[model samples]
Target: MNVETETMKNEAAPEIRIGGGVPVLGPRDTPVAEVVHACHSASIDQGLAALAIPGLNRETLEPVLQYCAGLRCVADNVSCPGCKRRTEAQGIETLDQFILSKKEVIVGDGRVRLKGEGTETVTTPCLETLSKQWSGENYWFWARRVIRKLRHGLRRAHMRGEPVAGEGETPSIILMEPQLADNIGMVARACANFGLDDLRLVSPRDGWPNEKARIAASGANYIIDDARAYGTLEESIADLNWVGATTARQRDLRKPVLTPEQAIVEMRKRISRGERCGVLFGRERNGLETSEVAVADAFIMIPVNSRFASLNLAQAVLLTGYEWMRSDAGRSLGRVTTYEKPLTEGLYLGRDRPATKEELLGLFEHLERELETNGFFNPAHRRSTVSQNLRTLLTRLNATEQEVRTLRGIVATLSQGKGRARKREE
Candidate 1:
């Protein structure tokens, strides 16, 4: 006699667990019924291999290939010899004969086996309701939802462990008063894309534990599940040792301003020294206010067209994350080296160390003194501008220690010539 078991609501659809693991039904949007029909449409003798009881179904068209792999083919019939012997030993008839006589069969567990028997139970777990749907209102919508849920479930079951962020010195992303759950989820996905995991939120407009965010996150639940929410911005970033505020507009603050590339270098430097760092992202509409910017130690500005500098919150986070990964990834960005032997390797490679600020400042003072004595600054009011111009010119060189000393020697020789001319005139 066939035994039937009641399936609980919101429970897993009946599935043949393969190798003690969840069965992979198929790829995303793979029709489950089609796979079942394909497996049973033709006889095994006609080059049709029956699917195994428990296995992944990547595509509904393929069904479960591993299922048929286990069955032994004998006399135009695909059957499990062991399973047939077990059931027959248990005083039951052949599995195929039993399936032909019964519509539903109950296994040892409470799970309802919709099809097959013995070692091969081809059953749909949580999709029992789909067996009744023929045609009606909102059928496709419900079908799509069910399919999506199944796809996610299959993916979850196949994974041996929860997905984690990549290993690196990724900075924490802090969202201040974020408005949309969609944006938050997108940001989490972007963070995952770049190996970033630490996500901190301050006063989200719709509050926390948002379902929409989880749905939007796709498969990056690790970030959403472990994301921290705080009441105020201060509380959110209180533990961070260094914070960089991302802003598009130029501010009058005295804090150091750096492009994304430069900011990542500094961030990496600090992280290497055992300091925790984070980036502050403002709301969607208006960016961080003056007070909020003041809390940050530095500013990170992405060089974009000034006319339209507005960037989506997720985009900004993605760009920053990309730069962070690129910083230490040893990725070459169009760096060129000479393939041929150089004529003058000494001059080019002699500069081993950069010139110290003090050395550069001393050179600047020495040159400025000689210039002042020679009346180079004719217009008294323009002295400051002239001095600034000279400093700017030197700053552009990024002179090395050797280069500074050489330049100082040149300046000293020129001063000596002027001194001799003045002495002769006297």
Candidate 2:
């Protein structure tokens, strides 16, 4: 069988042949969802050119490109087969060869036009429809991320272990009906930030194990990898003995309302007695319904300006995690590594002690002597008062031993003028 016949036999749907025998995944009228799936499953070597559905130009390609693992010409620079062969013949294996040899395609104002080649132009769908379909989703930026991952591998691929919070140490963070995958990724990062280990999701709108969430997670792969998604809120919190729902709006429920600090404290107390505790966060658009809030043992209300009480999904989780870690006995002020020690609340004096009384007195005398030589006291009657004022000023510095020595050196240098003054005296 020929390549076309073999290709058609293998494909689930009829292939639309383009660019002289290159197999397009579907017909010209293929839906956006199928196009996206085809692009994701397409081999990196074949690229977007092979999956040429109608209206699959740069403007409409972002949503498809983000899901793709490897598409060699996903950038503004479009690579042709001839250029690839030429570069390969010259033994150029780097990405620069492909980038340098490709033609530039300009995408803007609902049009995709090739600049360097024959100037092929394709008009895209209306902006309003695009916006409604993918609100706040930047597919082009996401495409770059996909290209980056294809080149460098997944972010923090080597990091894998138990959660930052040890077994049963921190409370499980539960997100209810999170709409955006990016928000979920950010929540994972926040969980990693303050040692909150477990992350549970109930009916995420974008579905679980999404690449967008993984990309947004930034480097909290461990949290994203282990995050559990349940069908319902009840199933998510089924394992926990006590759960607290976070809300900014006032609810008429009789459940006790506590601040983040108080909730963390209460959870800690319950966990000490071997109870599994969790914190429930609401959806991004609208918070938990009264019934959902009612299911929780207590409702947590973070202190905020009454006018603007709503917080971002990740922000709520971050605040709760911060409170959980704030009172930890082993917690450091910041990151403590091998060469950097844990800091406390005080003045940091490294390798130097406070100035001794003798050192301080010597500084005072030296300063006073210099002032006397310079006639800074003005009247002789005011000499005692001026000297007393100068002593007080110097004493208030609370200088270290090294600081005292440096001040004395500065005074000597100013008063005597070093080598020149000695030569003039001689």
The candidate maximizing TM-score is 2
Q: Which stretches of candidate 2 lie over 4 Å from their true place?
A: 1-131, 134-139, 351-353, 378-388, 420-426
lDDT of 2 by residue, 58-160 (tens): 3445544543223333332232232232344445565333233335433356365334332233232443332243222332343465455555666776666
Among these predicted structures, which one has the highest lDDT? Answer: 2
Clash list (residue pairs), candidate 2: none
How does model 1 score by TM-score? 0.43
Q: Per-residue lDDT of 1-426 in model 1, one digit per residue for the tens?
A: 222212222233334322222222422322233333333222221112344322232333222332333221222232222233223434544445544434555443536454543455333333332232211123223234334443444223232223343333568899999988889989988886676889999999878966556656666777888788999999998888999999999889999999999989998898888788899999997989989999999999999999999999999999998887676555333323575332331335442688899999998998898889888988978988999999999988988998898887777768777577446435
True-vs-predicted CA distance for residue 24, candidate 2, Å: 6.1
lDDT, candidates in the order shown: 0.65, 0.71
> Candidate 2: lDDT over CA atoms?
0.71
